[model samples]
Target: DLNQHIDNEKCTKIRKQIRLKRTKIKKYKKQINDYSQRKHKYEVQKSILKDRNSYSKTDHDATFMRMKEDHMKNGQLKPGYNLQIATNSQFVLFYNVYQNPTDTRTMIPFLNTIQETYGHLPEYIVADAGYGSEANYMAIIDNFNRTPLITYGMFIKDKTKKYKSDIFNTQNW
Candidate 1:
């Protein structure tokens, strides 16, 4: 009777060991699945970063830019290209697509394109305040041999200020 009792105790211990092994297997399988998912996500991100101007999954060449039209009132980024054009008398003389989102950086490349196509630069470049920068101003003067009539970012604000005293007015002359 004592031998039979010992045999039963050993059988119960073996069953508990098997149950613990099964639970461990399930936990390991779940961890492996999670690791695979994380690895796949990293691979996709790496592929997107391989392209310089890519901001969208559908269009790899498009860049994220802030548009003037914001219906939501929040500045949302949209994937698009900068379209630069040189016009004369309301007619489009030359047009170029730039990958850059800012007008400040697009000036030199657009001027270079115009020179490459027409073999000469325009006499004057009249652009908005968005294209105004020290580098852009020098590029127009040095490379294109033209003057940029571009307004600085604070041109309008500076003109509207009424000084309390004429001592601050440099334009009084």
Candidate 2:
């Protein structure tokens, strides 16, 4: 047989080469599996963080926002919720936890939630300049049929002496 004719040294050399190739193949398979697992983990994290700028790894639902007290004082964003609370007299009327950090986009939704949940609407709603905008005023007047006592963005600036004394000011005209 041809197998019987092969030299022992040549046969052993061939077996060693085959073993080396097998080890390389196994390593490649393991690397491919590792890559696949990493890709799957990234996809899952992305799904959890939909539409958010950043999310806390410790708390998946928590979004990163600037806190009122920044211990670091470097404007470092920490994971937290934007809490909107409405109070009448001394008691709490309605409160909401929002994912977005800005208060600008929250006023309308806060009013809508109160109306839907409690089946009531107040005649006059008071809010700060941060919640003031033309769109918010229109929604309050038209959609909610309520009066908004919200200060416009330039309300404070308009009260300045320079602005009040200027004859060329639009309000003066």
Every model's TM-score: 0.67, 0.72
Whole-model lDDT values for every prediction? 0.83, 0.86
Write candidate 2's Cα lDDT for 1-173 as tens digits.
22333334366778676667667878999999999999999999999999888899999888998887987789988899888999889789889998887788888888889999999888999988989899999999999999999999999989899999899987887
- Top candidate when judged by lDDT against the true structure: 2
Scored by Cα lDDT, where does model 1 land? 0.83
Task: Write model 1 residue lDDT over 29-77, tens digit each, in one string.
Answer: 9999999999999888678756454576768667888888989979998
Worst 10 residues of 1 by lDDT: 1-10
- What ranges in model 2 sit over 4 Å off? 1-34, 163-173
Off by over 4 Å in 1: 1-54, 162-173
